[model samples]
Target: MTRMFRDPVFGLDADVVRRSVENVAPPGAATDIVDLFARAAWSGIAEPGDSTAGFLVSAVGASAALAMLVERWSADRIVRESMVDVDTAAFATQLDRALVRWLPRLDSRSTVRQLTLAATCRAVLVTPEHPSWPERLDDLGPHAPLALWLRGRTDALRDTAHSVALVGARAATGYGEHVAMEAGSGLADRGFVIVSGAAYGIDGMAHRAALASQSTTVAFLAGGVDRPYPSGHSNLIGRIIDTGAVVSEVPCGGAPSKWRFLQRNRLIAAVGDATIVLEAGWRSGSLNTAGHAAALGRPLGAVPGPITSAASAGCHRLIREYGAVCVTTVDEMAELAGMSPGETNEDAAARSSEETRVLDALSVRSPRSPGDIATRSGLPVGTVQSVLGLLELGDLVAEKPEGWVFVPQRP
Candidate 1:
């Protein structure tokens, strides 16, 4: 039987899409580009960490899964008819709900758009079959992304097998930023690729320090690689694409939301060999990433900050409550993450554990309270006014609306 080989969208030969995939295909990726295309479609259809998406793709195939969604098959029919070989009872339980969540977003154009957008953005979709695919992510089991939508150096992802994730608050303070910079630069110097979500504050500082140290860094975005999140970091993200990679589970044109951000944190935790909360507030989202790392059995690190700082409270909580290793210096972070001796960063700066640099951030000229200060500084503010009075004595700044302004220094 002569099977017709064609892409339903372009009505051209299926090989047309296959050739397009080759633009970003690494040396060891799946040779069949059509299957790669299917995975890309499904990536957009399902949200990140959708186990049902993983199960469907695993039981059948990306192409067949796409076909199931395309044809609008019912959950009962899919389990009874298509997934006949599998254990139906358990899979069917959640199958209906999964379809409900997935079907509303199901637009054929959505999948087609991912391919066209990938070509325009010079992006690649890497599946488990790909040689450069980070094998460690498979440890996520059914929660693994259906496939990765990537831009930048595909080779950089392989480093994820031995990478460290440094994540913390976006409203970082001078102290927190300094530690993040030191930690990021120091870890990158140690030959470990840095992994993070490219948000402002801690995540941004980590990415910057990694690049400054001339080490590769990969960022996982909550949205499509085509549309980077926090839009403020466009230039920073652009720089990353030139050297490392920006990856996402969602397809092109997808906007980021609150749920996606939380889900994206899991990828950050999963992609790294270890995860460290450089500085986090009590309710900071970085703590969420820390939770995933702990759950995944990845070594977790919490950098200690001032005892009074609410910014580092999350880190303190982790150290005290979650059993996260206390990682003060870069060496400790490396040791905590189990960095191989051979992976040492030769030109790493000669800095001791006790040495801490203050990475000052000039906040917007508005009255911010001590809590806000700690959030920005990665320090905790004392609930007592005496602490502010002490700094006032030091001539740091006269208080205005309970906020502070730097006092001019004596020459």
Candidate 2:
């Protein structure tokens, strides 16, 4: 078995040090491999307890020839080894220049903390060699990211057979909230785990609805999986950690940033079987995810809403101009995910519409006179007065001496 360690940076997973120490080849060459890779990764010297040293050790320990090259091979030789056939000297020069430019940034405290956290988060770090790695991501070719930082259920990651990303504006309206809940809950019922960023507004509503339905959901964070952004959803994020996964690439302790947010959406698009835009404005970030999904030739879906709604404009534009499929019910989302919508469960109505009507007749600020119900519901005043009498009988709505209004059962 590959020896693993509890990495202090990531909190739980096997640390690079453990992997290097146990897996180092040639038996007695452990110290040599560790020293060479650590120094190469940290500019030809080793520092105790340094993560940069750990990374170097892990990267070069895979091949002793690569390890030795750090001391002997020029940048050209390094490039030659990296590819099947390339100009060795020129490649070495290019590699050296690139390393010179890139290595300093790695020394930054922020970068160190982020990479260490990334290495440790419960999320598994998948490599190209990992059997569970999805081949479809190779479609991006060289443009694809180096690796993925995954949290939540690994089954969802390994099963690329089907998944859907549902995203929208964070500042959701009542319509957006209702639609997000319906879509998320409906998708969950259909066996499609809802995937989304755990932002406020639509994202929060979608996660809550998915959880309420007792279905799986995945959240992709722009920062480290350990650090939930927006802080307000810390509780909801905790629930997500329990029921689903939280994912990132930048490593633990990485602060959420504008660039990372946009970059993270590409993973959501590539991994998902489809991407759905429930609600967004012209400037919404959700559209970026949609664009990536489209570019990847994945099926894209959008929810239709009132044209007058600014929040709906992005969805409308995608459907009307970009050929995105229009969806409403969970069945549609399920079919798009290549699954069948299972039988729906029925829940007994806790309150009837008549009871709701009575409650609506009452205002939070003041009692609505019996005449107010007639105006609000477009019913005859006599009918309204009778309904009010029944509601009053039920103690749902109250009648003030001056007129009538609502008094909630609670506060």
* Top candidate (lDDT): 1
lDDT of 1: 0.77
TM-score of each: 0.78, 0.63
Off by over 4 Å in 2: 1-16, 19-75, 84-101, 107-124, 128-135, 340-411
lDDT measured at residue 347 in model 1 versus the true structure, 0 to 100: 17
**Where's the lowest-lDDT run of ten residues in candidate 2?**
1-10
Against the reference, the lDDT scores of all candidates come to: 0.77, 0.62
Residue 214 in candidate 2 has what lDDT?
Answer: 87
For candidate 1, report its TM-score.
0.78
lDDT of model 2 at position 96: 67
TM-score of model 2 (CA atoms): 0.63
